[model samples]
Target: MNSPVVRLRGLTRSFEQGGVRIDVLRGVDLDINRGEIVALLGPSGSGKSTLLQAVGLLEGGFGGNIAISGTDAETLDASGRTELRRNHMGFVYQFHHLLPDFNAIENVVLPQLVAGRARATAEDRAAELLTALGLAQRLDHRPSQLSGGEQQRVAVARALANRPELVLADEPTGNLDEATSDRVFAEFLSLVRGEGSAALVATHNERLAARMDRVVRLHEGRLQHQGKADA
Candidate 1:
């Protein structure tokens, strides 16, 4: 088997409230391999998002080790971490945070542009991805002009725009209705798998979680009760 795209060991996070310590994550060890899609399931306040944040390199104040694509995040400074994320990580949230000003294609194109790709090339890639996601006709539509599902689809396209090695999503379908969520999720899974990027997606829906390659539950500040998908 290939090495993990994401590895965490002894990962822990805490916060102080009223001179009392609240432990969110306590020593979480996980490995997500290349092209694997792992589902994270937990109740609200279970620290699922905290774990994703740590692996995504979105914040500091975390204790223990986080390694992404073989590089120990602890060894990188703030700027270095930012560079690592830019080159190797993609993120999707419950909300489609698309820039209302830009059209679907442009929202997707912006990331590649920031990565220094030529404007023409970036636009081409964006169109290709959006088209594959069934958004070819909607490419010119702005976020407000599209339906909720369409907006989320555009967000999915944007997340994969950089073709990052790992995709970290915190309830990417949470805000959508069931039917829309299912459709969008199927599209998201197909696109991510087609790109061969490992993904760690957090969701509360058991049916969706079961569809993934594996499922893990967060309980008492640790990952527990891991289960594999049906063959």
Candidate 2:
């Protein structure tokens, strides 16, 4: 059997605010298998988003170990961590952060272009991904021109553009309406699973969280196995 694509051991984080130390994550131990989708479910201030950032390498000041694809992030220097993040990780947020000036395909291809792929090659791959996501007709549309669901779909395509091993999403459908949110969530799950990539999503929607293979809840600065039952 294959090892987990992501592993966290004794993960802890704290922040200082107004001369007070606030413990966010106590000691989290987690394992995310490749091609699996896990939902981090919690209420306000439960440390769901914070844990996502720690695993995604977006924030430091965290003690303990985070291994991605078997690479120990705790031992890596700044540059090493940056390299690993850029090449192996992806992220999506509640809002679609698409550039207003760029078309759909261009926005999707931005990461590949940033990684130094030739513009033509990147554009070609972006077009292919957009088409696969049923966005071929909107390829030249700006974010404003597309519906909310459409824009989020483009964001999903962009996340997969780099063929990343892990994608971290924080409340990805939090801002959408109920029907549209469900549709967007389904698209995200399908896209990640279709590519055999692992995803960790932090969401408040119990119905959506229940559909995932596993559900983890963050409460009182610690994690618990709420399982699909809570959802």
Candidate 3:
């Protein structure tokens, strides 16, 4: 009965370049329980992004297990993997990656529409999330018209559009200034918590990571639990 939102075991990944193998992940095991947020701490090029990519099923060519909501990723074919990725999780990146042509609310509503939600229903959901993130007044603004923080806020809102069980954010605020970063991160935590979604957020900022429920560091392609966030 303790089924987690995400599970990884004995996960290993390596790349071959110039007839030499470079290992990125080495037998990593992790579980993200429902409604829990875990911070992944590591230096640049330390395989943090690679680790996220593995959990994300963004690509293949790895070994070991990845189970999302009890379904094994290895057992799923390409279409199945796409279905699983779309239905169960959402991803946020350092860059907003918003559609230049779409407005704030439209960006959020598009994903929901892809998931079979009705246009009106999706729009309502989008407005709710944007309002919660303090973007009620900017609903019609394009990404270019918005500030960096506001654009990231729209990205966050879009990531959460599906009410996914797992939200994967890779240094979501890394592109912002110190003050803007703090503000956006705070809003992100609040929105995710309010939605009752578990999150694996990758960030190098100890101060920001400490705000999560737990923290884990990556070293030598392995995961080391660093205890609870408050610890």
Candidate 4:
């Protein structure tokens, strides 16, 4: 197998509420290889989002080691972490946080622009991604002008704009209706696989989890690998 796109060891996180200690994650050790899609299964309040935040480098106060694309996250300062995220990671949230001010193609293009990609090249790539996601006709529409599913599709296009090695998504389809969720998720999986990027997607849906390359569940602050594609 290729080198892992993401690796975590002894990863833990805790919070204090009302002078009481709350442990969200407990020594999570995982490896996600290139071109693999791993479903993170858990119920609400089970620390699924917490784990994704830790892996995405969006959380401080996390304990233990996190390596992305082979670079040790512990060694990086804030700016370095930002750079790492910019160049190597893509993120999708439950809500489609597309910029309401920008059109679909422009929303996708902005990230690449931030990463120093040329305007023309970024536009072309954005167009390609949005088109692939079945939004060719909606490219000129703003987020507010589109339907929920359309907005989410644009969000997917934006997440993939940078061509990152690893994609981290948290409840990406949770907001949509069942039919829309299924269709958008299928398109999302196809796009992620086509881009050759590894993904760690957190979701409460078992049917969706079973469709991934592997299924891992978070329970009682620990990770349990349920199985893989062939297993």
Give stretches of model 1 more than 4 Å off. Answer: 229-231
- Alpha-carbon local distance difference test for all models: 0.92, 0.89, 0.94, 0.93
- Give the CA lDDT, 0 to 100, for residue 96 in model 4: 93
Q: Write the per-residue lDDT of candidate 2 for residues 14-129, one digit (tens) a residue.
A: 99999999999999999999998999988988899899989988878998889998899978888888888889888899998999999999998899988778999999989988
Question: For each candidate, C-alpha RMSD in Å?
Answer: 1.3, 1.5, 0.9, 1.4
For candidate 3, the lDDT comes to: 0.94
Candidate 1 weakest ten by summed lDDT: 222-231
User: Highest TM-score, which number?
Assistant: 3
Stretches > 4 Å off in candidate 2: 229-231
Candidate 4 lDDT, 48-132, residue by residue in tens: 9999988899979999999999899989999999999999999999999988899999999999999999999999999999999
For candidate 4, which ten residues in a row score worst on lDDT?
222-231
Clashes (backbone N, CA, C under 3 Å), per candidate, total: 0, 0, 0, 0
lDDT of 4 at 2: 52
Better of 1 and 3 by lDDT: 3
Q: Which stretches of candidate 4 lie over 4 Å from their true place?
A: 228-231
lDDT of 3 by residue, 1-231 (tens): 969988999999999999999998999999999999999999998888998898889999889999998999989999999898899889999999999999999999999999999999999999999999999999999998999999999999999999999999999999999999999999999999999999999999999999999999999999999876558
Q: What is the TM-score of each candidate against the true structure?
A: 0.97, 0.95, 0.98, 0.97
Q: How many clashing pairs does model 4 include?
A: 0
